[model samples]
Target: MLPADTESESYRFYKSLNEDILLKPNEFNEWDMQFENGDVVNVTGYESLQNAICIAIMTRFKELKNPLYADFGCRIHELIKANKSRMVEYKIELFITEVLTNMRRVKKINWIKVTDNPNNEFFKYLVEFSVTSIYDKIVEGEVNL
Candidate 1:
């Protein structure tokens, strides 16, 4: 082992969890990850980082079905069915920060912004943000709340 903090922060942080279980958000909803074929998908690099970001933000804190993921989720679910307002926007931003700020793949959160869409009052929140990944690559992601 290298002594005294010789490893790069990205490598050190993402040493163990550099990839996530293949769960395509676009294809599946609510963690129901499945493919047409009975084959498992394994991914790494930026794609894994992207999936991790989405999973963290979409999950309700302590709401995961898996006990191992008891602590892997965002607290924004508390705002579900909440009235749209500035305070809600702020809280959304805060919650996103709290969740993504600590991810092993995230180097730094560039910015987080919440916008309202007047079309769907019940469930229409667009949360957008940018982050520097552990590989020193800037990746942009968004989550709908």
Candidate 2:
């Protein structure tokens, strides 16, 4: 369970999307501040959750340079790079479940839907899922890869 302070707060601390900087709320216009500082603007609530899920799914495990960030991603990318087979889909489902559930903010993953994209020249899948946050907020999102 999330602490009462986290659950009740209107804004949550998150890293910038493009840069490794933290965003904090203040009396000054936050959006302008981000642009002025050359940091990606912050996201809130469902958008924040969706971004996190997308990042986890898209990133390959151990792809990051820092060893401490080694476990922050899923193995879905490996499956995508492998030969197309039924087993790949099954592995994707399992990987998604494991990665999403392990996230600090994700309380539970309701389901993950993987669909084949035959026409896409690069990506072979369209992955979708619904997740319930530790704060009890349910949000659904999709990612193509």
Alpha carbon lDDT of each predicted model? 0.73, 0.66
RMSD of 1: 7.0
Q: How do the residues 17-126 of candidate 2 rate in per-residue lDDT, one tens digit apiece?
A: 12222233244313122333444555555566776777777678878888778688898777645886668878888899988977887888888998776456444676
lDDT of 1 by residue, 1-145 (tens): 2122225463455544365456764522345454535555544556568778888888778887787777888888899878888899899999899988879778899988888883465557888889888668888877666
Native-referenced Cα lDDT, model 2? 0.66
Off by over 4 Å in 1: 1-17, 26-37, 64-70, 118-122
Clash statistics: count for each candidate: 0, 0
Q: Which candidate has the top score in lDDT?
A: 1
Clashes in model 1: which pairs? Answer: none
**Could you tell me the lDDT of residue 66 within candidate 2?**
88
Residue 129 lDDT in candidate 2? 95
Q: Which stretches in model 2 have alpha-carbon errors above 4 Å?
A: 1-39, 118-123
